[model samples]
Each structure stands twice: as structure tokens, then as C-alpha cells.
Target: MKYKHKYSLTPIAIAALVAFPTAALADGPYVGVSGGVVLPEDSSNAGEFDADVPATPDFGAIPAGTEVGWETQFDTGFAISGQAGYAFENGFRLEAEVAYSEYDVDTHTGLTVGGANIDGADVAILTRGAADPANPTVGAVIADGQGKVTNFGLFGNVFYDINTGSAFKPYVGGGIGYQWVDVDYMPSGVAVGADEDGTFAYQLMAGASFEVSDNFEIFGQYTWRDSTEEAEIPLTLVPATLGVESSQSIISAGVRVGFGG
Candidate 1:
């Protein structure tokens, strides 16, 4: 009698077997590169002279009461970034990234010496005249200018992947970091430069990815990023400090390569 011998796998053993493949698929290191378009919100600032300068009696230059208000609109620009990260079997990931972006100036507005709001072109004329010794009547000039804002950021991010047992994965993430921001303006033919260092920065992101092979994937993402109020930049004669605030949204697409799982 070849008596039948019965054997059964335990629940734990079954679970282990089912999870083995998922663990292998989820554990790995990856590197990615992305490029995108940046759409900026408006940036604005107001400034006044730190101190009034007394005129020399001989020169007869009266103290100029100078104040300025500035508003700048930005055009769409380009953004690029690189990241490296590791994924876990529980669908969590961590990454470090570096990014760069540039935005063009669309418009600049200013306050005039005559206590009226003026266009940038008129401000430029006032600024030019204020710099000339012959045009003593112009107390202050605001200039319309063209320039670019460039920023570099470094961030540490965390994400969660919604794996649906298919080639496609969707994810959501957020990050906090530091940024170096530089603003260069050619206002009234005079160069004005300002920079902020180690400003607090943050971002929110969401995206989906398609696996192309065992070691490669492609993705598209949308992100919103912002920095804390920037440090002040000094301006001419009146010793005014200019302040700027900025933020933007971005759409990006990229490729990623995985290392061993």
C-alpha cells in the first residue's frame, strides 16, 4: 500500500514566497536627470534710503528724499536637475538632488520722485538724469530693466511609490533644502547685482513612471517650489535696500537608471 503522505506549506512560508519577488524588485539605487519649463509668479519689493545725505554748503546739493517701489513679472524659463536615490521594498524612497533654473524679466515698475507711479521707461530717464550733475532737479529715478534670475538648489527628498503590480508606478514626494539665488539687472544702463545664500527652500512633487527594462525607466512630473524672502541688495545714492520674493511651478520629464537590487 503506497500510502499517501500529505504535506502542506505554512501560511508564513507562502507569504515569504509571494514577497520574495517584490523585495527583489523594490530594493535598489537609481540615478536620474530631468529638464523642464518653469513658470514664475510675480515678484515685488519696496525700498527707501537708509539715511538722507546732507548737501555740502558750497555744492548747494539739497537732501534728496528718495524712495522706490519695484514689481517684476517673469517669463517662462528652463530648469534642469539631477538626483540619486534608493528605494525600499515597502515602496518608500529617499533621494538627494541638485537643480538649476533661469527666469527672464518681463516687466519692472517703480515709484517716481514726484510721488506718482511711473512706467519703467520713465524711471530709466529719471535714473539717468539723477546720475548727471547737470540735472540737479531729478531727486530720484526708477528704471525699467531687463535681466535674469538664476538659482541653484540642493535638496533631500522622500517619496512613496504606489506600485500596482504593473510596469507603471505613480508617486508623490516633498523636499526641503537650501538655495543660492542671484539677480542681475541692467536698470537704466546701470548694472545692479544681488545674491542670497543658504535661503530656506522647499518643494512638492507628483509623478508617474514607466519601466522600460530591468534597469531603466522614464518619468514625467509636476512640481511647485519656493524660497524664503531673499536678503536685501543695496542701491545707489539713497542707500536703499531692495528685497525680492519668488516662487514657481514646473513640468518635467526624465530618465532613470537603476543599480543592483
Candidate 2:
């Protein structure tokens, strides 16, 4: 009887040890840093310009036979963001993210004609830094003597994890959010092209999160948004004509860190 009792106790001890390791590897709470390049699937609208004002000193004067063909182009910059998330035992999770990226578009054309085209011939030609509401007159000109537009926003997401037993896990998620933007158009002989305006924006996002360790990993994502801004500009020199409007979508990749159960 004594020998049988000892044998049963031995099996129980072995089972307890085997189960401990598996429990230690499961999910819990954590914090991390995620950063990468942001590439939007839809173009972000920088702003618009519709001014029939005189040119400024910088642009001199309107040239004879001068025509305007303006465009806005986007660039690829860096993205850095921080996020916190929770994973439930059933593989469901919710996350809130705040990411900031420098979104910009360049304008290459803003010309005038049948005028003097003097030393300040390029005056009233709107460029990147025209978003200030100091001089309302300039703002009015860029607005086609009407209105202007600008683009900027914020977002959030939800997802479900795939159970693969392996150390590596992948996730799919979707998000929605809003943006606050500003546009300005100021007129100055010295300042030339100027503008100011603001708006509330929106967007949608989809991406995958990678888990490298129990505490860290990397991810890549794509986002699409509706971005539009308006500004005003005025000319103090020769007659001026301005046209600035365009949109772009961006793409990016980055890494993340985790800290939790």
C-alpha cells in the first residue's frame, strides 16, 4: 500500500511542472513605441487659391503672354507615434493611437500675363507658407476672392488576433478619426503670396501588427483621408492670378515596443 501511494504522488508532481511554462507565455497588458513611413492611399488636399488681385514686390508684375498652371505634390517624411493596448484571453483587443506626420504638398506653377511683369512680377503667387490669417485681403484673393481650404486630422482602431501556437502572431485592424486644419493668406509687398484658413478632416486606416517578443514587435500600415484647406492672398503690385489645389496618399513602415502580461 505504501509503494502505490508514492507512485501516484510522483505523477502529480511531474504534471504540475509541465503546465507552468505554458502559462507564463500568454498575453497581458503592455505599452510600446511604433514608428515608420506613412503612405496614404488617397491624396491629401493642401488648399486652393482663386485671387484676381495685383502682384506684389516679390513677384514684380504680371508679364505679357504670361499663363498660370499650378499644382501641389506630396513628399515622404518620417512618422513617430506611441500606443497602448490590451489583449483579452479570447484573442480580442482594443487600441487607441495618436500619430503625427508632417504632411505637405509643393506648388510649382503660379504665373500671370498681359501685365507689367516687373521686378515683383511673381507677386501674389501662392506657395507653401501662405497659411496665416494676418492680412484678410491676401486671404480673400487666394480664395478666388471667395474661400480657401486646408487638411489635417487624428484617428483610432480595433482588431482581432490569430491564434497560431507559434511565437509569431499577426493581427488585422480598422480605424476612423478626424483632423483640424488651418489656412491663411496675408498680403504684403515684402511678403508677396500669403494665406490663412482651417477645417475639420477625416480618415480610414488598415494595417498589421507584428509581435517579435513578449514585449516588442514591428508593424506597417496604410491610411486614406479626406484633406482640404482654403486660404486668401492679395497682390500689392501688378495684376495677379493664382491657382493652387492638389491631393496625395502616402505609405509607411515602422516598429513597436510592448510591456504587459
Which candidate wins on TM-score? Answer: 1
Candidate maximizing lDDT: 1
Q: What would the TM-scores of all predictions be?
A: 0.75, 0.50
Candidate 1 lDDT over residue span 1-261, tens digit each: 699999999999997666543433336898999999999888776665555544442332223446655677788999999999998878898999998999987766654432456442322243333334344222232234567788899999999988877677889999999888777655544455455545888999999988766577899999899987664666653455666666889899999888955
Q: Which segments of model 1 are wrong by more than 4 Å? A: 1-26, 53-67, 110-144, 236-238
Q: For candidate 2, lDDT tens digit of each residue in 1-261? A: 456544345787886655433322236655555556544222222222234434554443334335432233344544555666776677776666665555333222232233322223222243323434452433233323212234444556566766665434556665555544332222222333344323334444555655555556566666554444322233323234243332324355555554455
Instruction: Give the clash total for candidate 2.
Output: 61
**lDDT to native, each model:** 0.72, 0.43
